[model samples]
Target: MLRPRKFKELETKLGHRFKDPGLLERALTHASVRGGKIARFDNERLEFIGDRVLGLAIAEILNQQYPEASEGELARRYNRLVRGEACAKVARNIGLGAHLILSESEADSGGRDKTTILADAAEALLGAVFIDVGFEKARAVVRKLWQEQSEPVPEVAVDAKSALQEWAQGQGLALPKYTVVSRKGPDHAPRFTAEVIIAGRAPAQGEGASKRIAEQAAATALLTREGEGGRLGDA
Candidate 1:
């Protein structure tokens, strides 16, 4: 049983106490910790739902704050905000890594500080909040953690894959092709390397927790290799 004070700091940070503390417990429980359980007690299910919750919340924010922006423009900002990287960043900001409930082996292997674990746990936490209360309450927590959208419009958050595709079209070149070169590490926490090949450009590669993120990374790598202006690259 978790001590009543165990989650005090996290609860304070979230600005809401859990009505059913098991939700928070489940959120923090990593898959590595579940020892062959028949029931799904880990955070994975919560992470799944939490991903949707976070996306919905951020989409709502973008809709209201960027009402004048085009769909593409909104998508860029939305992608940037809802990414695993952003979620990990938020987890770190809230000191969420320290609270992960990992198995002895996982903890010894530094799973607590891992980017994927932290990001998934962050989403699970949000999902737990949603289940505990409702969307309005969960959205409020997201808004607080993500902060008010009062800053000037950010320009650097463009979706790299989209930009790469657009660049290829603009240049009258074949579309960029992404291939998963390697997927390594444990199933619970996998690492993927993906390569991007454009018809006239030298292939570039990047790695991430998932194939989609790896593809994005590969696109970003190709873009960076080209030029600051995303110019043509050497074959």
Candidate 2:
């Protein structure tokens, strides 16, 4: 059983105390915990619901914030923002891991510090908050958590194809082209591998379920590698 004093401190940090208190208890409980009155429900269901809710909230925020941006660009930024790493970073910032009710094995295996676990827990926490309060309150909670990470529109183009094209144009290089390197698997579900080639550099390769997606992946890989290695401007 969690000590009353500890529960009080947790509630203080959470900014809202549960009326039933069991709800909050279940929110922190992991499936691994055994033989406890509060261990009946795990956090997985809440995590699932919270994932969608978080996506919707963030999507709405991105849509309003970047009206001129293409959907692909918005999607990339949205992906980065809601990714597990980002969620775990937010979880750590709020000291959420210390409040989890994990199994002994999980506790010893560094589960408390695991990014995936923390991210899932953060989503579950959001769901608990939404169920306890309301959508507006849940939005407020997420906004508070993400306020520091939110930024003004980034100057870097988020779409790989757009960025690659702009880079090529700026360097006075011939426009890059994508070619299918190979195809594999059944015709109905063929996997395509494509390469993006620029005028004077080694080509970058990517694989995807379709030719168009493969091309985009190739562009993404090439842009990422070039951007990081400082070869993009010279190409």
Candidate 3:
């Protein structure tokens, strides 16, 4: 059967023709679009399964690709690859934003471009594919999409927060302070917004599912700005 125009385009981008396009459609449907209560119809259930599917696929790849790496190293690399930012980046690369089905309010509020939503949708897609096909095909898709980031594992994968602290200490600056700017979403999946303030530097803001992730994002943002130029940091 011919698919809808949007799903056709999405399938092309994903490089996987779906036998059941309904799976893809449901995966792209956000909770906000479905009144936040359609447990069986929304993407949240798919997202939950997809998270596991993604984790397993990544683990298999990491194990095979870097046989010499230790468990700790593999764990770090896996964390980086499976993080919300990583998923969001893949979603953007595949132009998944344009295919999302969000409520009018969500669309008006820029839900299509939100990191969390995009990431969740990406995971849901993976889950849908896993269910539609088999593990091997899902593995192939993961391998293709995540190839760029599948380089050899580093000896030490210092998190952004740790790296930022080390940089600050190296510059003889006081330790950066992180404040929770806002918290939203359901209890199961709360979104936290954090702002990090460095002495003599302007604050940078980031959002994530937890306080730790938000702080790390904020620190990473600050570090990225500093690396780009002296102005963004100063501002």
Candidate 4:
């Protein structure tokens, strides 16, 4: 069946055509919208299914891509890949934000560009794709979208701080700078707050007993923010 010109354009970007056009529309519709044959929840259920759907797809992709990597290594990469930031990055790449249907308040508040909304909408789109076809097609869409992020781990698996430094250097940036923001609490237990700064980005802060721990925590926060799973790996 023929669809509106906009959906056809989106399908071209998704690299898949939907057998039921309504599924594609539902995937793009946000929960905030209510009325006229559209419920406030259609996309949410799709988002739920998409979350699991994405996990399985990413796991399979990792399994095939990193045969030599340890389970821990693969898990870290999986966490990074399945994280909201990563999904939001993909949504942004496809210009998915522009296609979203949102309530006036939500749209005015920049729901389209908001990371959480974009991530959920992205997964919902995957769910729509899964339903329209099957797991094989869903995996194909994921592989096509996540190709670059699925590359081999760049730095040797190490502590969060070391990993963050290597990540920054890999991106051709200066080493991360750690600063002590405050020291509080009693002599029996002193609390330290440290902030780590990567050039051109805002600082991420973490708190711990000692300056070293605080620095490491800060590094982990930054790496997590950058969606590398911080490489902490059960630390």
Candidate 5:
């Protein structure tokens, strides 16, 4: 049996008590540790269930928070909130990585800090909570942790590429350029990596499910970097 003290610390962070602490333990177990066959117990099943749980909670929140917004607007906001990167951010905020129980080999390979792993585990944790308690309790946890953290959704939802273009023009600079760095994953859900280059500045990269989305991600990355003191060339 896993130690009670370990789960106690995690419960404190999660803001919920688990009658079956084993549920939380299972939620934190990685498939890599189980040799990819989770017959014993792993986060995979929980991650699956949690994905739907998370989506529903976020949809409900967005619907309530942006009452007058169009369906398209709500969809955009929903996508931003439920993306893997966003989930990983929430996991980091709650220090979920510290409680993960990885095989020695997995931990040595830097599994603890991997964004995909953390995001999956975060979802699994939510799933475990839903299973242990119920939808409403899990939802309350999600709302408290996630509701106030998202950047305000724009009314029209401009793509990142257009936003960056307008910004560069306002600064009297040449238009920014984007390049497809790589494409990987299966055909059904390929991942695209894009790099955005600006005059006299280091390139910033981003990844997404499509070239256009990747380009938008790249532009957003560059803009965020520049906003955080990564300078751009003057007019």
Candidate 6:
């Protein structure tokens, strides 16, 4: 059995106590260590419920905070915010990784630092909180946990064209150029087909609702091809 002192410390930090601390213990336990023992429930089911709770809480937060933003914009921010990397970052910030119980083999393989595991554990903890109390209490807990740390998400320029151009620049290669292969549809919403041509290789083609977006898609395809061939320059 896990000790109460550590859980008490965690509750102090989190500003809430579990009526049933076993839920939290289960949330921290990984399947790698637990083999269907009655006392050893893994956090997978908790992760599933927590995922929904997280999405709803984040959506409500975004909707309330950014009333004028389009749903697409809100969705983009939400996705970036709730992604594995983001969740792992939060887990690290809260020192949740320290509490995880994994098998010796898994721990030897660096399970403590694994982003996927950390993120899953964080979600499971949220679910545990939800189960221990209710949605309103869960929301309060989440808000308190995240509010001080939350900041506006920076926009990622991860589109293909930018990646390709960066790759070219890093390799001292010639810049890529994009040309429209075809265009169709109404003036207000045209579909553009673009071809991205690298200096020494075959051009890659992509289509999007806009020329810039299509060019970016094409650039991404070209980068993917180069990556597969082991030709992309060092990051």
> What would the TM-scores of all predictions be?
0.73, 0.63, 0.69, 0.68, 0.68, 0.65
Ten-residue region with minimum lDDT total, candidate 3: 226-235
Candidate 3, superposed: residue stretches over 4 Å from native: 153-157, 160-235
> Could you say which candidate leads in TM-score?
1
Pick by TM-score: 2 or 5, better one:
5
| Arranged by lDDT, best first | 4, 3, 1, 5, 6, 2
Q: Pick the candidate with the highest lDDT.
A: 4
Worst 10 residues of 5 by lDDT: 226-235
Model 2, span 85-140: residue lDDT tens: 88999889888888888999999999888898899888887788788877776677
Give residue 216's lDDT in candidate 4 (0 to 100).
88
Writing each residue's lDDT as its tens digit, candidate 1 over 93-192 gives 8899889899999999999889899999999999999999989999988998887432436555456786787667667899889999999999999999
Q: Please give, for residues 1-235, the per-residue lDDT of candidate 4 as tens digits.
A: 6798889988998899899999999998888886555454459888988999999999998888888877656766887899898999999999999999898999999999999999998899899899899888988899888887887767445678767876786688988999999999998999999999988877899999999899988998888888887355543
Scored by Cα lDDT, where does model 3 land? 0.85
Q: Residues 139-174, candidate 6, lDDT per residue (tens digit)?
A: 776676667444555444444544566567666788
Model 2 CA deviation exceeding 4 Å by range: 1-3, 34-40, 153-235
Misplaced by over 4 Å in model 5 are 1-3, 150-157, 160-235
lDDT per residue for candidate 3 within 25-143, as digits (tens), equals: 89999998676465778899999988998999999989998888766457667877998999999999999999999999999999999999999999999989999997778777888
How many Å off is the CA of 184 in candidate 1?
16
Instruction: Give the worst 10-residue stretch by lDDT in candidate 1.
Output: 226-235
Task: Tell me the lDDT of model 5 at 37.
Answer: 72
Q: After superposition, how far is residue 112 of candidate 1 from its true place, in Å?
A: 1.2
lDDT of 2 at 37: 46
lDDT of each: 0.84, 0.77, 0.85, 0.86, 0.83, 0.77
Model 5 RMSD vs true structure: 11.0
User: Which stretches in model 6 have alpha-carbon errors above 4 Å?
Assistant: 1-3, 36-40, 152-219, 222-235
Please give the distance, in angstroms, between residue 235's alpha carbon in candidate 1 and its true position after superposition: 25
